[model samples]
Target: MGFGSYDESEQDNQEYDTDFEDEDGLDAEENAHEGDIEYEFTASNDELLDRLEDIKDNQNT
Candidate 1:
C-alpha cells in the first residue's frame, strides 16, 4: 500500500484511553445562575412614531 493507504490489519491494533478528567470544574452537570438582565427604554410612543415616519420618508426618497 502507499503512504496514506488504509490497512484492515492495523485497525484492530488501535487503542484509545477514554478515562480522563477535565481540569476545569465544568465536567459535572450543574446549573449556575449568573444574574437577571434588565432593560429600560426611555423613548416615548410619539418619539418612536416620529422616528418610524422619518425612516419611511427617507426610504421613499
Candidate 2:
C-alpha cells in the first residue's frame, strides 16, 4: 500500500559521530584572508567615459 518499505529497527543500533574541530580550523583560515584582498574599482569617472566613447566610435566604424 505504501511507496516503499522502511525498517526503523535497522537504524536503532547505529551511531553517528560529528567533529567540529576540523571545520573550525577551516573557518579560521578563511577569516584570516577576509581583510587581505581590497575590492575596489580604481578607474575614475572620466576614464570610464572615455573608454565608453572609444567603444561607440569603434562600433560606428
Candidate 3:
C-alpha cells in the first residue's frame, strides 16, 4: 500500500537540546556543591525506622 496524506505542521517546533537555557541563552550549573559530591558508606539503625515510617504513612494515605 501507499502512504496517505500528512501534515508537517504537527511536528515539534522547538529543538530538544537548546531549550533549557535562561533568557540570555546559557546552560546553568548542574551541581550546587563544589566539584563532585561523594557518598559515604555506613550502616545505620535509622534506615529501618525510616523505612517502616514511610510504609506506615503510605498505607494511611
lDDT against true structure, model 1: 0.86
| lDDT tens readout by residue for model 3, 16-54 | 665554666554565446668788857477986888899
Give the least accurate 10-residue stretch of model 2, judged by summed lDDT. 26-35
In order of appearance, the predictions have TM-scores of 0.40, 0.36, 0.29
Question: What tens digits encode model 1's per-residue C-alpha lDDT throughout 12-57?
Answer: 9999987766763474446766789898989999999999999999
Q: How far in Å is the alpha carbon of 17 misplaced in model 3? A: 77
Greater TM-score among 1 and 3 belongs to 1
User: On a 0 to 1 TM-score scale, where does candidate 1 land against the true structure?
Assistant: 0.40
On TM-score, the leading prediction is: 1
TM-score of 3: 0.29
- For model 3, the superposed segments whose C-alpha errors exceed 4 Å read 1-43
- Scored against the true structure, residue 36 in model 3 reaches a CA lDDT of 81
List the global CA lDDT of all models.
0.86, 0.79, 0.70
Instruction: Give one digit per residue, the lDDT tens place, for model 2 in 1-61.
Output: 3678767787898877666576555565555654476678899999999999999999999
